[model samples]
Target: MAQPDVPDCPVDALTAECLSRIFSHLRPADLAAVACTHRAWRQAVAGEEGLWRAHCEAEYCLRSPHLPAGGAASGYKAAYGAWRSEFGRYGELAGRALRAWRLVEDWTAQHFPAVAASFGMGASEAELDAAEQQLGFALPPALRVLYRVHNGQELQFDRLVDIQRTAAHESIFHGMFGGYSFYSHLVSCRMLPLRRMVKWTRTAHTQLDFPRGDKRALFAASHNFNKMVYCDAADGLVKIACVDKENCLQAVPADAAGDPARDGALRWFEAYAAALSSGAFAVEALDAENPATIGICLFPQLPPGRSEAVTEGVRVRACPLLIPELTQVAEGERQYFFAYSIRFSLLPEEEQAALRGTLAGPAGGAPLESVQLRSRYWRIRDAAGQVVNEVRGEAVVGHYPLLRPGEGEFAYQSCTHQREPAGSMEGSFRFVEGSLQAPGREFDAVCAPFRLDVPDFIF
Candidate 1:
């Protein structure tokens, strides 16, 4: 058979628009290959922000089925709506401040019962007066209202952990056991069933060891309790562990032998439990002290386009955003931006097979071949749009063994970092003959550029 006349011009001869239109018809992986062809092809694809947005939208919709459409637009709106409904506007500032004041008032009343009785109403009233006299600063309007409505008391978890078995075990085997064994760890803490309401008391303290640096210690305290809060979406939950003290002690260790230290620690746990039961401590204060708490709630945004199936199978559309602003607790202090990739599977096996066959290989199977398609490397740009960080990489593709008539699946690997915010990767594969022969042919792969954004922590 005579081969079609080779074009006089190079593949780069195609116009940018014409190239993009053709590239768009290819699968994402194939389109990437096209970019590796040359600088011009890369520029055509790299300039398109819409492509990245489409990927993000598809992932979001898959993860959050209840979320509305319009992709990222709908997802963001839904997240904001939930935030407002739960905490109200300016909730982060006002709600936190108000909650803090209420907690302080309650703490004063419980620890200073004598003074509280003198004031007739309780310690909260006296504490408020003392704050005004000492700080010479009036509480904010919202805070004052919150204090008036909520007399100081430890807020209880909607549920608490049951420790009856743990308490019994401790009482029965007091002297025989010095510390919890590995197998008995969860049982000793009464955490086996993973109950939502059960709470266990444990003491956590820090010890400064000369060579070892600062070592933090955590042990089951006499009356302290920990609650488990779960999040099905994140596939994990946070445990809110708390403790309190009637009078501050210098310090104590879990393995301490001295009766005085152990007695003081136990007393503190008793008081802490009392505070929690009586509603003396504020939940906001505890949360602020442990911002990295696993219990903190997270709200995720969804992606664009509804699920659809073509001859190739189902296509899931999603969009993901990289919010550098939320990457760290201290803004701009962190090196990497935190972002998530959104993905969803929409097609059945039959459709997926059809799509793969149409997209994977060249038109005629004259012993399959491979080729390079596209590559895009980007640099971090400054405010004025000057490239700052030099980022580069290439994409390639090539022929492989044909599948048996009924076999449709193929396996390949790509190395992409799940952490680094900026960098590039590139490489190529060559054909091999049985044993050790060379089949002088090669193919190209595509490298796509993307940025990471940290999603919002709504709760």
Candidate 2:
């Protein structure tokens, strides 16, 4: 006799065992995407605390020193022990992992003797107090704890860029090139042939020297993030460099020359500079009244079929929000939640057609004659996966045109005056056609995922 079929149960749809098996086959980001699919999946995945723990361990291993792989408990124990042994203080270990404190206690003593004692061993409260007074602002909380715990155990030294070497005599006519260096809150960029450095120094009164022209540019920024620098020559050459640490310097010949390259480089620089200034690309205090503004300097991936144009006008619109009233600092930082409705529009007919075609392809292809997209104030999740706040806004759009190949602007509305460190927004766009029915297509746009760090203003 055949057995009766078992009815499907909700738990059976996603049992812990099944979910674990599925997770093993996917990456962290992929797992995150899957988790966002539905509440059931989210609950199942969330229950598997082991998954997140393993992910954290893997990340720590990759970013920190070498370590053997094991279960979450083993990895955590090993990491904790290693950290304690290296730093001799829990606060110090945590600070280093968070990248809030540089291993500069000793370096500070060596270079700036006046402030060295306060950071050295057996430092007194009075000494630290005095130092803080002199600096004008309180030291980052993590750094403060690290200094108190580690004292003078200087394991990580601040890397200074060798500007003189990178700026020295390099071939200019071969093609356009550029270099970048960051110290604290300052980021300096110069054109190749090292000519731009000369112009910048003369015009901006910023001294730069190239001691070693062969070395690469330093990649250190105040906030933790990798940056890529590109140089386009007047002829048509393009050169690119990846900056990983501070005080780095390097040079390379451009890939092309002429107007196209120059325009591209200039556009990119503008966007990059804007991003840097906006505080959206770095860590900092969240103050709505003093909201940070970020800009995109270049749009190399411009709408296709219009590479020869010299100038393009891009429109950016944002719906602003004023909510999450001011409250005392939590976790030593002020908290506020602001929402924005962001949109991009005024795209050329050709570019719009290209976008529509691309969207209409096999996976996301949805035919449309006109498309207007907007995002509501969705919830913002912190690194801990906790809902910090919600954002609400209308759809704001911007139009960007390409005047020439490899050059364009990404001008848009700026509403970064919220008290949250970093949050992502996702929504859908409404598409319309002359003859077809209006249809909506989902799109995800990243509003500045970078940190907003407080500036260490010397003046």
Candidate 3:
């Protein structure tokens, strides 16, 4: 009774949910073609608002201002078009930046909500346009996305770290990016708000001397010192001002770290995310009494830049941090400064059982009460692997810290000079198993090599 069997269209056989999922993979144009073939496909494309919503989230990341639900394109499909018209210049990059920033913000929100709160709300298109207009040149695509995400830090809160704010803020000595203390220098780096950034850029003509035709822009600075961050608009290379050098700036290429790039802003943020994911930074309280001022330290807490070694029962962990605020280029020689942290400790009593062979006590093979550092040695090398200098000293910073068993680390920081942007430091400490007054047999505790190079990313 039936004629020859009729074939069913494969797409027609799919449920609406399945069709929506498949359409998710296709571009808007491809989906449009499917809509023309049949009424079912057309309904799926036009009626499923969630499909278009997914597309919006995938592309814009909400970097564009929200369109009212009742606006011309209330449907997500239509909203997508409206956003494209306005904020599509760096949509892909903006989306990626937004995601990475969310990760960093989430970390701050969890550990230091005060700093997170200091982040400015996203800059509007009009505001960004005005800044670029006054800046006299268009912002690079990398920076445009950053401004859209956050207009930099709020100065009042920013001063809590960069400047000597009122004592009311407590011993809080750090900002969003931490600072190091050496001699009398106490400095922290912070992002400049849009207003300050504009002012700094304008004042460069008078306050700071730049070579004629030079167009490097300043976006960040330390309040108490000449430490500043600059960017070349011509190419998005981020640089730090070398106050001691005439018209010289040090590179701080944040993306691909050390590999120079044309775009700096987005790469800068990407480098931060990489540092955070790599555990190169930590959120800690600058002042124990003020939890609100907890801030991030850019010092590397792991790998290539951080080194660890153990000899007998003594353990040494060392790391280096480039001091951008102290860069200087003078007299045919460039001097970059680095602050290094050396953390040494003796193994706990329980863990020391493995080292008893070399550390056995005189009475019953028990471990010694402590180890006394006698001398220290440092080997410094330039990026070329050539030895530049060696240091042999009686004691570190004029103190022979006793490494008592099972106690916490005896940590201190000192700085050194490197002629180039990159170099390495490795050393060993001569120690005795007993106290300084009653010394035992001497041994060397190795300090693994650690990097002393300008960071791929500043904080």
Candidate 4:
């Protein structure tokens, strides 16, 4: 006994907004079904762009499809359909790849904005197929997803020497992935686009002893003569082609590389992303006063890879770097040359106030009126915990830095040879509250114990 005034369909009585809200929880396939039900249902569902956008975001982790140029989201429904057709097979892997890049891009935006902008747009299926066809092989599943997310980075500068000169002047254009700079050279690493990667692979094979039926391609490299990173299609290993001596290839140990069977390119990308998330790497300002001096550096920010402490609002971060090139092993004699960097800075009053209760000495505390490096005391020990060398020095490498609050850390790198394969360094630095010229209150900034062991991953 339906009333004459009542509408025949339930949706006829409901507003479009309510219908849209109900449709939001439905899957894309179900929503498409709703669209085909009747003219009223189709009209109600067809125009709800938010619903389609939400589905795209949830499934692909993309804010916009940005398809067919002009960024016309006039039809998010079209965008969702396009994404499904393009990347549906990748599924969870595509989402993971997107999320990984998002993390790296976020870090880059916060620290080095220009470099973040250098990342190339994703490659299409046709482009990827062309690359594969040219190479006579296929990219791995995970790697395929990565390329579909971002082809790679295009370095903006001309050469490594330019980057070196820029860094020497304390001006840096971070490229690819931001790298650490010291002394005369800047070793900025950048990812190569697929086309460039293919070209480099051909060059590498031609330069080296070419192997038949093998696909070893250079995927990334420093702008200079550091090391070239490669992906092996035959074996899922991300390797570094060492240029020194025999030019031996070194793959990251399985211990550091999770799930060895996974595609090396994807593993490398995910590992880099993990490093950013875990504080193993940080983008920091090279100079304290110049915010523009910020760049990406591989100075570890967490324990194991790094040791840190704050004394009287001054923070000291020390990390060890393994020089595999200098590593010597011969009959009962194993020598490992390790270089360590000491970066210390006096915290600004405002930062100290902000870090109160969170950081050690700054907890509801006071900032240093002034600080100057005076001397260093380091106790280097071997793997057996026996003291190898005890260094008591007036100034680190001959410069006593006059620390200033809010100015960047005074960073220095020095090499030390260890008798054993592994060792540990524990030390402290003497600093005066005022300048070295004008003596005032003094304190010993503790340099927490840090390891000198060779890492599984030799980057």
Candidate 5:
């Protein structure tokens, strides 16, 4: 009996349909592991379109419509393969963006507890599923994580802290009471709370009446400026729309989108998280009615070394790179990488008492606030006027430069990666007399527009 015993074929013995049923129970990663078992198993699993599709759907919530086209095969398995490949490239990036958002949450809770309290708890899977169903599109991963941590939040702004509606309040004092009449008053003002964001967004999408091809898409946040920050599904970028504009709703680039360091669409969630982490901007709130009593004073918190550096006077000027050096990029890609130089100079006059008065008080000894570059946001356009690339963010480099008079210039490098044959770059530097929070007078130093060109290859 022992001599007659024999081993059966491991997994290859299973029928294709049986194998598919078994693999369906595995996650995407587990499915991948078993795929390398044997030639027969690999072919059997790879060809099982339904199995791969099920894995993709379970992991990413991706359906047929969300899949990419032009694969060698026009089956679900090919689409799943394409998505898996793209996920491999972008998955880590999505994680980094989520980490950045979590940092922002921690910062907000520590610095602005009252505002943070309104954020609530992280979203549940069912809520996310409902939101996706309602929006009719899959949210980007970072944005999904952002909502899970907190449904939405209020940004900090001092003087202009509330969104203005077209109808003025009958009586501001009377509207403060808590009752049925107060509830009606709140609705009349068009207050947009993040928890009910989906409802208002649906209304905006259906009733606001953007052009036929241009839907209102989805809203990310509502601002005190009578604007709702929303996504343009047409471009997958974020834009700010004037909700209380004269006539129809008009959308414009959000502040982050206006910066040269950002994508033209501002790529919404990721860019916002990055901006918070980078200290390029701060979100603060104000609730006091009296400006004099407002708690948002910008003085008295100057960094220790800042006052000493500014007291001597710092000269600041803009230096442009008329020519940029270019290098060939990756294989099979036509893009070129160019590096441009920017130099800053601090003039002797920056130390004068008149300058001190404008910056800090003449008696206080001015501590420099910021040296920012302000210009029309830069972009590279092709012959058809399509934006090949757009830059965004604040300041030329991440930090403000402190330069001395006449001795030397502070040099920094900026780069642009473009596939276009020709394009140009231009912008100006804005010097903040005080600090970022309480910026005084802003002085503009312009950088004239420069051409981006590539010569014919000799070799």
Candidate 6:
């Protein structure tokens, strides 16, 4: 419900520099709310580049400080626009955003308790009324409820890099705007070094390009970024536009289908929530880093005379990959479970034709069109180099599948048990084919030797 309006009381009395210092502590969403209050307040805090950029980093989870590829020169606002576009590429975005935000909230509370304290508790009815009156507009129910949850965050140190490094870090309470009863009081912070910042409000009619008689105005301004988030009175739809010092505002549509949510304004509160959960707001998934994300080199050893062998004129290739899940491991016994997928793409033409003909013509000899292995076996060795176990099975996953040329993938689950903490496993799939000329022909598809070791912690 942050809309363009004039600040009437206490905020009107403060000097622009004083206002900026106080407003610097407010959350980005709160800052957006204040941006519409008046020209002076907007110029003080909403115009600062560092403010918007910091807000972007903290809200979007953006790990990189430098502008992302194709980021707008307008700074955080354009960066946010670019960021929203990137989020559209992900699947199950809403679910991921919610889960990720929950993780972020937990992490902040545990690791950065002082900063976490900035996330304010909900506002009161009077406070909501005050905010609404200041804007000369009715606050939406969702937006009112949102502010009630957290009036605004305290100052964000991670976002404001140029601030007093030692002092800001040492005094966690300095930038905080706690115990403030009024809406404008929430916008004021005292931690920053005071200075003049640019104005984000539209002062002249020439700056806006909305249709004649259109009542759209800026509710949120991207600090130093030449972009503004506005509310279109025509539809109550939140929207974003590029700002040019010399030119008029230009609306930026996010989706080809012209969906406003895709452009990043789902709703005032919903957009704020989306922004809070977006990948751009929180780039680091967790505080700890995983070494596996970098890279891993495997040097597995194979047993002698245990390699793959295919008959002449009958070409079939099996390339297997294993995915191990710690949850799949047995607790009582030292057992490891893994899902494996092997792709068969190099079957000979004659073999493929024979296989297809067998599957398509009629169910005659073997009804194995969906199964891959007729028989399979695995050999496991302990860390001490002793053969710990051997497993021989008929039909992987309880079925024998016929593999097609260049288009077939076989998947199955396997379990290996060992008494030792570490071990190695290697196996082979025995594929049996029956043709008109040759009744029974056997071929071997080798599974690469892979080592397994339990980690200290599952996560």
**Per-residue lDDT for 1-459 in model 6, tens only?**
555568654345346666767666887658767767766666655467676676566555454433334334466655655554443333233323423444535544654455456555435567666655544455434334334334444445434644635333322222221101011111112211111111122332235443455544344432222333454534444444422322222232233455333322223333323333332122111101221111100111121211222322122222121112222233453334322222233354555446554423212333333223477787778777677788898875565666544444333333444454466676676765552233355656666565554422110
Model 3: per-residue lDDT, tens digit, 1-459?
433333334454457778888888888768777777766677788877777787777776543335522235557877777666656767467667767777767776876676677778777788878988887777676776676777777756345544645544422343555555544555556667777788777786456666665656677666553677777776776777665524445455434545343567677667766666556777653322334544675556788778988777788899788776566766685788888878888888776776565532222357657889999999999998788899999988787999888887776678887778888988899998787799878888889888887765654
Task: Write model 2 residue lDDT over 251-327, tens digit each, in one string.
Answer: 22232434222232223333333333333222211221222311111112221200221112123333332222111
Q: After superposition, how far is residue 412 of candidate 1 from its true place, in Å?
A: 12
Q: Candidate 5's residue-wise lDDT over 186-260, tens digit each?
A: 110112233455666676666666555553344443222233455454444444443232122212233444443
Ranking by lDDT: 4, 3, 5, 6, 2, 1
TM-score of each: 0.22, 0.23, 0.80, 0.73, 0.36, 0.31
Winner by lDDT between candidate 6 and candidate 2: 6
lDDT of 4 at 39: 63
> Where's the lowest-lDDT run of ten residues in candidate 1?
175-184
Candidate lDDT values, in order: 0.28, 0.32, 0.69, 0.70, 0.43, 0.40
Query: Which candidate gets the maximum TM-score versus the true structure?
Result: 3
- What's the number of clashes in each of the models? 65, 72, 0, 3, 20, 18
Give me the runs in candidate 6 sitting further than 4 Å from their true place.
1-46, 58-372, 433-441, 456-459
Model 5 worst lDDT run, 10 consecutive residues: 175-184
Better of 3 and 4 by lDDT: 4
How well does candidate 4 score on lDDT at residue 132? 84
Q: Over the stretch 1-459, how does candidate 4's per-residue lDDT look in tens digits?
A: 431232335454457677878899999889877766656677677778788788878776667755522265547788777767778888667767877888888877776677778777888888889988988787776778887878887654433443554334232335445555444434556777888778777777776766677776677766553646766676656666542322434445442445544555665677788787666776665333345556666657677798888877888899886655455554455567677778888888887776676544543366666788999999999888888789998988788988887897788877687766688998999988788889877778889888998765555
Candidate 6 steric clashes: 18
Best by lDDT: 4
Put down candidate 1 lDDT per residue, 1-459, tens digits, no spaces.
Answer: 533333233345457567767665554456456556665555565555445334323322223312221234344334333333322432333334333433333444554332222211112435544543433333332322233323222211211223233322222111100111111111112111111111111112212121222111222221122211111111111112211221111221222454221222222223333433344222211111222221101112221111111211212121222222123222343343222222222233343444454533322323232222233233444334345565444422222332222333222211222233342222222222111133333322221232333211111
